[model samples]
Target chain A: EAGVAQSPRYKIIEKRQSVAFWCNPISGHATLYWYQQILGQGPKLLIQFQNNGVVDDSQLPKDRFSAERLKGVDSTLKIQPAKLEDSAVYLCASSLGPEAWETQYFGPGTRLLVL
Target chain B: AQSVSQHNHHVILSEAASLELGCNYSYGGTVNLFWYVQYPGQHLQLLLKYFSGDPLVKGIKGFEAEFIKSKFSFNLRKPSVQWSDTAEYFCAVFSNQGGKLIFGQGTELSVKP
Candidate 1:
C-alpha cells in the first residue's frame, strides 16, 4: 500500500503571487487533512475533509486560502496573494475514517517560501 | 479548542542513555492521544497511540508513552536510546467529539555516539 503523496516538494513565490499544492492520500482512505507547519513549530490544522465534504476548516484563512477535494480521492490547497507569513511547509494527511482512534498517514509536505 | 504542549524544544544525549520527553494537553474531555516521529527529511510516522484501555502504550522502535488521564499528560520514553533514534517527536490529541488532531510544538532529539 502506498503512503500519502504530495507534489512539488518545494515551492517559491513572491508576495501577492498565488500558489497551489496537491496531495494524493493512501488508497481507500476516506478522510484527508491539510496542515501548515511554520519553522520551529509543530503543524497546525488548516482544513479537513471527509470524502468530498469538508469536516472542518476553522483555521483556514478564508480571504486568501481555499481548498477542494474533488472526487474525494485527490485534493488541492491554494493560497492567493501569498504573504511572507505564508512561508511554511504544507502537509497533507489521510486516515481510514473520521473516528478519533483512526491513524492518520502523512505526506512528505510541500515547503513554500514567499518572497 | 484544544492545545498540546511539549516542554522540551531540544535535547542531546549520548547513545544508550535513558530518554524522556514531556507532553501536556489541555482538554477536559476524553481524547485519543498520539506520538509521531519525523526523521530528517522524512514524513511524520506514528510512534504510538493511546485510545481507551491501556495507560502504557508501546510503539515501534522501542518507543513507549504513558497516558495519565488524571494529569492530562502523555510522556514518551525509551529505556536505551540509539543514534538512529534522533528525530523530532510530536505529541497530538484528537478530541472524542470530532475534527482534526491538535499537535504540540515538537521536541528535537539528538543522540551522540
Candidate 2:
C-alpha cells in the first residue's frame, strides 16, 4: 500500500555535470515510467518499462539520458552532461500492468536545476 | 503525433463558484481519457477516467468530466468548488494500443476561501 518512492527530492548541478535519480515503485506493480516535466508544462514520457524489459523509450535522449530497471522493482534515470534545458522535474510512475485502463500511481518528483 | 491541450493556464474564482476546465486531444484512434489532480506539494492523483460507456464520469471530490469522442475533448467540471479544490489539473490520454499516457500542459485553479 505504499506510494511510489523517489530519492533526493531536489538536486542542483552545473551544466555539463551528471545527475541521477532513483525510484521505488509500488509493490507488485509491473510497469514503470519516467517522465520529464519542464516548468509550466505537462510531463513528457522519457521511457517506459514493463518489468525488466523496456516497452518504449522513443523520446529518450540517447546521447545524454539513460535509464534502467534491473530487478523490475526499482529504477534509475541518469542524465550526463546536463544542459540548462534539462532543468525540470523528473517524475516516476508505476501501474499494475500495461493495460490502457490501468491506473498509474506517481511519486513525488525530483526537481533538478542546472546552473 | 499525439498531443493534449489545456486551454486555460491559470484560473481564480471565489469559493462555491462553478468551475469548468477545457481539454482537447489530437488522436483519431480509440483512447482512454484521464483527469489527474495535483495538490500543492503532492504527487499527481487520478481524479477520474473514461474508458467506455458513459460520457459523463464522476470522480472523487465531486469532480466530473465529460468525454466527447467526436470533438476529442474531455473537460473537467465541478458544480460547486471549494478552496480545498484548488490544484493543478492535467488531462491525459492512452491509446488502446499503448499504455503510455500523453498529458496536457495543465490548468492551475485557485479558489479563494
> Given the true complex, what DockQ would model 1 score?
0.86
What is every candidate's C-alpha DockQ against the true complex, given to 2 decimals?
Answer: 0.86, 0.88
* Model 1 native-contact share: 0.84
* TM-scores for all predictions: 0.98, 0.98
How would you encode candidate 2's per-residue C-alpha lDDT over A54-112 as one tens digit per residue? 99999999899999999888999999989999999999999999888889999999999
- How does model 2 score by TM-score? 0.98
- Where does candidate 1 clash, by residue pair? none
State the displacement of the C-alpha of residue A42, model 2, in Å, after optimal TM-score superposition.
Answer: 0.5
TM-score of chain A of each: 0.99, 0.99
After superposition, the stretches of candidate 2 with alpha carbons farther than 4 Å from their true spots are: B97-99
Candidate 2 local Cα displacement, residue B98, angstroms: 5.1
Candidate 1, residues B1-113, lDDT tens digits: the string is 68999999999999999999999999989888999999998999999999889799999999999999889999999999999999999999988765568999999999999
Stretches of candidate 1 off by over 4 Å are: none
